[model samples]
Target: MKKNKTLSEMTEEELVGEFTNASIAQKEASEKDKFSKYNKLFDRIVEIRNERKIRPGDRRRDLLPLLTHDNIQVRLMAAIETLAVAPDAACRTLKEIKDSNWFPFAMDASSTLSWFESGRFRPE
Candidate 1:
């Protein structure tokens, strides 16, 4: 029997690769199963919330806490992904962060949320 690699043992690239592969595989398997798979992956993200090493967009809800991550890249990506999924909910959070020191990221989130709310980006 082969031992599975723990997420902690994987490099950032490896973790992203695994997530991408899982996403693709789940998408191809069955439309009805997609949500379950996505939820499972999301659960995995929740399990590692404190690990401080998750890939961007791993968990939609993770964006809330990441709005204040020390790394701008992480914060920006989280804001973008959160807006993409829930523009309305992101609006308030974005507003709260807009005047903070991380103005650039807050602006990105606010703009994206506005665009979505404006019907410029319709769901497919």
Candidate 2:
């Protein structure tokens, strides 16, 4: 991986790779958060959030259409990651590309929507 390059300096392909890494980290079953890979991805995701905070860039929103990326992993990652920065827009997009109910990643995206809709913690 290239070092010292800010997230803003990354190309679209590089951003996709970073998001893919994040998706992997999020989906991993191991109850570990100290791992370098996961931490690195977490930082990148935060960087994106902060970037959007300062200036709402069209480049960032460009990722919206990637929800239907030919690669399912990319499509899956795009939704959950985008949810952090663009919840309303991400939810709208997720509704269109969420694949069938049987798609595991679709379920992941659905769960993210549920997480947002139900609030952080809801007790029965």
Q: Pick the candidate with the highest lDDT.
A: 2
lDDT of 1 by residue, 1-124 (tens): 5378777766555554454444344334334556677567555543444333354544455455655555543444445456656665555555655555465455665676667678885532
**What is the Cα-based lDDT of residue 120 in candidate 1?**
84
Error of 1 at 53 (Å): 19
* Candidate 2 TM-score, true structure as reference: 0.50
All predictions: root-mean-square deviation over Cα? 12.2, 6.2
Show model 1 residue runs off by greater than 4 Å.
1-59, 62-64, 84-89, 101-103, 122-124
Candidate 1 is scored at a TM of 0.38
Candidates in order, TM-scores: namely 0.38, 0.50
* Candidate 1 colliding pairs: none
Worst 10 residues of 1 by lDDT: 45-54
Where model 2 places Cα greater than 4 Å from the true spot, the runs are 1-4, 8-36, 56-59, 81-89, 92-107, 119-124
The global Cα lDDT (0 to 1) of model 1 is 0.53
Highest TM-score scorer: 2
